[model samples]
Target: MRIAVVGTGYVGLVTGTCFAETGNTVTCVDIDQKKVDKLKGGTITIYEPGLDHLFLRNLKESRLHFTTNLAEGIKGAQIIFLALPTPPGEDGSADLSYVLGVSGQLGKILEAYAVIVDKSTVPVGTADKVRDAIGKNAKVEFDVVSNPEFLREGVAVDDFMKPDRVVIGTSSERAKALMQQLYAPFVRQGNPIVYMDERSAELTKYAANAFLAAKITFMNEIARMCERLDADVDMVRRGIGGDERIGKRFLFPGIGYGGSCFPKDVQALFKSAEDVDYDFRILRSVMEVNQEQKTYLVPKIKRYFGDLKGKHIALWGLAFKPNTDDIREAPALYIIEALLKEGARVTAFDPEAMENVKRVVGDKITFADNQYDALNGADALVIATEWSAFRTPDFEAMEGKLNKKVIFDGRNVFEGPQMKALGYYYESIGRRPVKP
Candidate 1:
C-alpha cells in the first residue's frame, strides 16, 4: 500500500512512520521546508518514545520518505491521510480551514480514485464538509473517511500500531474494505474494528477525551472536598476505584488536565453543542472545575509564606504531564504566572521541557539545571507535573538545598506522614498535612 500523510506534525509523522514500518510505502508531506528537510535527514522532530527507531529504520529501508511538495509526495498513493491540525477557534470550535483547504487542493490534483482519511481530530460533520470540498473539483471518485486517532503523545507509535480498537466511519464499502485491509495487520490481537457512521466516528474521539477530562475534573473536585473535610483523596480514590464501574486509571487528582487532547476536545464538544443550539451543561461545569484545578495550589502557596512578595519558590515540574515535553495549557504555567504576579521569584526544572520553555517564556523565571539545583535557596518546593523522578528524591538533599523545609505538592507525589517524619512542612492534595 502507498500512503501519503500530510502535515508531518506529531500525528502525521508517527502515522506515516508506523505505516511504513508495517511494509507500506509512505511519503510524509509537510509544507514547511525546514521540517521536511529534517525528516528527510532522519532527524526526529518530536519526542515520542520508540518512534525514532522505527522512523530511522524505515527511512534506511527506502520504505519511508519526506517531501515538501504535496502533489509529488501524494502522486500515486492509494490512501492519503490528512493528519493535519484542526486547532480550536476563538469560540472553541475546531477550525476546519486546514482540513478543508487541503481537501480543496486534493480535489484539484487527484487524477484517480483515492481514500482520503481524516486522521486529524475534527468536529462532527467535518467528514461531509471535506467530502463536499473535494467533490466540487474532483474528476475522480474519492471517499472521505473520519478515522480519528487516539494516540497519546509519549506512546503514539505503539498506540497507532496496536490500538485497543479501530473505528472507521465510511458508508462506502470500497473505502471500508481498503481501510480494513490496511489496519488488519494491527488488530491481529483481536481488538474490534468497529464500523459506524462518519458523524459518530468524529464525535467518538471528542467524547472519549471529554470523558477523561471530566473524570480528572471530578477527582479534583473530590480532592477539594477532602481538603476541607480532613479526608484523604488517595484513600477515597482507592475506595471508589475498587468498584467495577469505577476502575482505577485516572483517579489521581492532579493539577488538572492539559496537552493537546483533553482541553481542546472538551471545549470542542461544548462548542459543537452550541452550534446545534444546545447547551452542554456538564461539559461547561467540567471546564470551569478544571480551570480552578490547574491553579489549585495558589492559595496553599500564599498561605505557606504569608506573603508571596520577595519569596523564592522552587517549582519541580513545568510540563503538562510526565513522559512528554508538551506544555500547552500546563498547570505550571498558571502557577508560575500567579507566583510572578504576587512578586515571588521562581526557579523551575523539568526533565525535557526547560529548553522549550526557554524559547516561549524566557527569563520569566530562572531555569534550573536539575531537580536538586532547582531547590537551591528556595523557600519551598511545589510539585506540578507528576514526573516519575519527583516521586522519590533525596529528602536530605532537598532539605539541604532549600533555605527552608517547606513543600507544596500539587500532584501528591509523597506520603504525608513520611514527609512529616523527615522534618518538612509538606502540603499535598487531600492528604494529611505533613508537619516538620
Candidate 2:
C-alpha cells in the first residue's frame, strides 16, 4: 500500500517509518520546512529506542520519504493518515484546528478514492466532523476512518511492529478491507483487528489512557495511606500485584503519571463528559490525586531542613520516566519550581533529558555532566526519575561529594535496610526513614 502521513511529530514519524518497514511506500508531510529537511537528510527528530535503526534503513531503501507539500505527498497514495496534534484547549477540550484544517485542504486536492485514517488520539465524534469537513468541497469519494494509536513512548517501535490489537473504525467495506490488509502483517500472531463504529473507536483511545492514569493514581494514593499508617507500599504493591486480576504493570508508586498522552487525555475525557452533562467523579479525583502526588515530597524536605534557604540539592533524574527524553508534564519540573521558590538551589542530571530541560528552564538550574557530578557540594540527594544508572551507586563517591549524607528518594530507588546500614538519613515514599 502507498500511504501519506500528515504531521511528522512523534506519532506520525513512528507510524510512517514502521509502516514503510513492512513493505509499504510511505511519504510523511509536515509544514515545518526545517523538520522536513532534517528528516530528508536521514536525521530523525525524535528520541525513541530502536526507531533510528528502522528509520535509517527504510530511508536508505527508498520506502520512506518526506515532503512539505501535502498534495505532492498524498498523490497516488491509497491511504492518508492524519497524525496531527490534538492539544488541549484552555477549557480542556481538544483543539481540532490542525486535523480539520488539513481535512479541508485534502478535500480540494484529493483526486481519487482513498481511506483517510485519523491516527491521533481525538475526542469521540471527531471522525464525523472530519468526514463532514472533507465532504464539503471534495468531488471525489473517500472514506474517513478512525484508527487511534496506543504506542507507549519508550517502546513505540515494538508496539507498532507488534500491536496487541488493531482497531479500525469504518462503515465502508472498501475502507475496512484496505485497513485490514494494511495491518495484516502486524497481527499475524492472531491478535485481533477490532472493527467498530467511528465514535466507539475514538472513545477507546481515551478510555485506555484514562484508565491507566487512574490506575497509577490509585497506587499513588495507596502509597500515601501507607506512609500515614506506617506500612510499606512495596510490600503492599507486591501483595496486590500478584493477583492475576490486579496485575503488576503500572502498580509501582511514584511522583505521578506524566507524558504526551495521560495528562491530556484524562483532562479531555473529563471535559467531554461535562459536554454531555455527565460529571465523571472518579476522573475528577484522579486528577486531584495526581497533582498532589507530583509534589508530595516537598513538605517532607521542608520539615527536615526547617528552611531551604541556600540549600543545594542534587537531583538524579529529570525525565518523567526512563528511556525517553520527553519532559512534558514531568514531575521533576514541578519539584524544581517548588525548590527554587523556597530559595533552594538544585543541580540536576539525566542521561538524555538534560538538554530538553535546559531548553525549557534556561540558566534557572545548573546541569551536570554525570549523576555523580550533580552531587558535588549538595546538602542532600533527591531521586525524581528512575533511570537505570541511579539504581546502584558508589556510596563512597556520593558521601564525598555531598555536604551531608541526607537523601530524599521519591522513586523509592534504595532499599530501607541498606540505607540504614550505610549510616545515612534516607527518606522514601511509604517506607520507614533510615536515620544516621
Candidate 3:
C-alpha cells in the first residue's frame, strides 16, 4: 500500500517508518521545512529503541520518504494518516486545531479516493469531526477511520511489529478492507484486528490509558496503607497478584505513573466527560492519587533531614521510567520541583533523560555524568526513576561519595534489611526506614 503520513512527530515518524518496513511506500509530510529536511537526509529526531535501524534501512531501500508539501506527499497514496499533535487545552480538553486544520487542507488537495486514518490519540467523536472537516471541500470519496496507537515509548518497535490486537474503526467496507490489508503483516500471530465503531475506537485508547493509571494509582494507595500498617507492599502486591484474576503487571509500587499518554489522556477523558455533562468519578480519584504519589517521598526526605535547607541531595534517575528520554509529567520532575522548593540543591543523573531535564530545568540543578557522580558531596540519595544501572550499585562507593549515608528509595530498588546491614539510613515506600 502507498501511504502518506501527515505529520513527522513521534507517532507519524514511527508509523511511516514501520509501514515502510512492511513493504509499503510511505511519504511523511511535515510543515516544518527543517524537520522534513533532516528526515529526508535519514536523520531521526526522536529516541525510540530499534526505530533508527528500521528508519535508516527503509530510507536506504527507498521505501520511506519525507516532504513538506502535502499535495505532493499524498499524491497517488491510497491511505493518508493524520498523526499530528492534539495537545491538551487549558481546560484539559484536547486542542484539535492541528488535526482538523490538516483535515481541511486535505479536503482541498485530495484528488482521489483514500482512507484517512486518525492515528493520534484523540477524544471520542473526533473521527466524525475529521470527516466533516474533509467533506466540506472534497468532491472525492474518502473514508475516515479511527485507528489509535497503543505503542509504549521504550518498546514501540516491538509493539508495532507484534501488536496484541489491532483496533480499526470504520463503517465503510472499503476502508475496513484497506486497513485490514495494511495491518495484515503485523497481526499474523492471530492477534485480532478488532473492528468497532469510530467513537468506541477513539474512546478505547483513552479508556485503556485511564484504566492503567487507575490500576497504578490503586496499587500506590495500597503501598501507602502498607506504610501506615507496617506491611510490606512488595509482599502484599505478590499476595494479590498471585491470583490469576489480578495477575501482575503495573503492580510494582513506585513514584506513580507519568508519561506522555496517561496524564494527558486521563485528563482529556475527564474533560470530555464534563463536556458531555458526565462526571467520571473514578478517574478523578485516579488523577488525585497519582499527583500525590509523584511527590510521596518529599515528606520522608524532610523527616530524615529535619529540615532540607541547603541540603545537597543526590537523585539517581530523571526519566519517568527506564529506556527512554521522555520526561513529560515524569514523577522525577515532581520530586525535583519539591526538592528545589524546599531549598535543597540536587545533583541528578540519568543515562538518557539528563539532556531532556537540562532543557526543562536549565541551571536549576546540577547534573552528574554518572550515578555515583551525583552522590559526590551530597547528603543522601533519592531513587526517582528505576533505570537499570541504579539496581545494584557499589554501596562502598556510594557510602564514600555521600556527605552522610542516607537514602530514600522511591522505586524500592533495594531490600530494606540490606540497607540496615550496610549501616545506612534507608527509607522506602511501604517499608520502615532501616537505620543501622
Candidate 4:
C-alpha cells in the first residue's frame, strides 16, 4: 500500500509511521517546512511511547518519507489520509478550514484514483463536504471515507497497531474493499472493522469521547459528594468497578478530564446538538461540571490555609495525563492560575510537559528540575497529574525538602491512613483528610 498522510501533527506523524511499519510505503505531507525537515532528518517530532523505534526502523528501511509539498507527497499514493486539524471554532463547532482547504488542493492535483480518508476528528456531514470540495476540481476518481482515529496519547502506537475495533465509514464498495484490505493486518485478532455510513462514523467518535468525559465527570461529582459525606471515593470506586456493567475504566476521580480529545470533542458534540435544535442536557451538565472540576482543588487548598498570600506551593505533574508531553487543557494550568490569583507562588515539575507548559505560562511560575527539587522551600505539595513516578516517593526526603509536611493530592496518589501515620497533613479528593 502506498499511503500519504497530510498534516504531520501528532495523529498524522503516528499514522504515517505506523503504516510504514506494516511494510506500506508512506509519504507524510505537512505545510511546515521546518517540521518536514526535522522528520526527514531522522528526528521523531512527537513523544509517543514505542513510536521512536518504529519510526526510525521504517525510515531506515526506506518505507517512510516526509515532504512539505502536498502534490509531491500524494503522488503514486493509493490512499491519502487527511489528518489535518479540525480545532474547535469560536462557536464551539469544528473549524474544518484546514481539512477542506487541503481537500480542495488535493482535487486539483490527484492524478489517479485514490481513497481519501478523514483521519481527523470532525463533525458529521464532513465527509460529504470533503467529497464536494474534491469533486469540484477532481479530474480523477476518488472515494472520501470517514476513518476517525481512536488513538490515546500515551499508548497511540499500541492503539493503532492493535485497535479494539476499527470504524470505517463509506458507502462505496470499492472504497470499503480497499480500506478493509488496508486494515486487515490490524484486525487479525478478530477485532472487528465496523463499516457504517459517514455520519454515523463521525458521530461515533464524538459519542465515545462524550460518554467517557461524562463518566469521568460523574465520578468527580460522586467524589464531591463523598467529600461532604465523609465517604472514601477509592472504596466506592473499587466497590462499583467490580461490577461488569459499569466496568473499571474512567472511574478514578481526579481534578478533571483534560487533554486533546475530551474537552474539544464534548464541546463540538454539544454544538452539533444545538445546530439541530436538540438540547443535549446531559452533555451540557458534563461541560459545566468538568469546568468546575478543573479547579476543584483550589477551594480545598485555600480552606487549608486561610490566607494564601506569599505562600510558596510546589506542584507535581503538568500533563493532562501521564506518559505524554501534551498539555492542551491540563488541570495544572488552571490550578496554577487560581493559585497565582490568590497571591501564592508556585514551583511545578513534570517529567515531560514542563517545556510545553513553559511556552504557555512563560515566567509566571518556577519550573523545578525534578519532583523533589520542586518541594524545596515550598509550603505545601500539590499532585496534579498522576505520573507513575509520583506514585511512590521518599516521604522523608519530601518532608525534609518542604517547609511544611503538607500535601494536596488532586489525583489521590496517596492514602489518608498512610499520610496520618507519616505525621503529615494530607488532603485528597473524595477521601478523609489526614491531619497530623
lDDT of 3 by residue, 58-168 (tens): 999999999999999999999999999999999999999999999999999999999999999999999999999999999899999999999998899999999999999
Which wins on lDDT, candidate 1 or candidate 4?
4
Worst 10 residues of 3 by lDDT: 427-436
> How would you encode candidate 2's per-residue C-alpha lDDT over 11-66 as one tens digit per residue?
99999999999999999999999999999999999999999999999999999999
Clash count, one per candidate: 0, 0, 0, 0
Candidate 4 residue 6 Cα shift, in angstroms, is 0.3
Q: What C-alpha lDDT do the candidate models reach, one value each?
A: 0.91, 0.95, 0.93, 0.95
Superpose all Cα atoms of candidate 1 onto the true structure and report the RMSD in Å to 1 decimal.
0.9
Error of 3 at 31 (Å): 1.4
Candidate 4 Cα outliers beyond 4 Å, as residue runs: none
- TM-score of structure candidate 4: 0.99
lDDT of 4 by residue, 144-189 (tens): 9999999999999999999999999999999999999899989999
| Residue-wise C-alpha lDDT for candidate 1, range 1-436, written one tens digit per residue | 9999998988998999999989999999988999988888989998888998999999999999999898998899999999998899899989889999999999999988999999999999999999999999999998989899999888788899999999999999999999998999999999999999999999999999999888888899898899899888999999999998989988999789989889999999999999999999999999999998888888988987799999999999888988888888889999999999999999999998888888877898999889999999999889998889999898878878899999899898889788878888988887777887
Question: Each model's TM-score, in the order given?
Answer: 0.99, 0.99, 0.98, 0.99
| Between candidates 1 and 3, the lDDT winner | 3
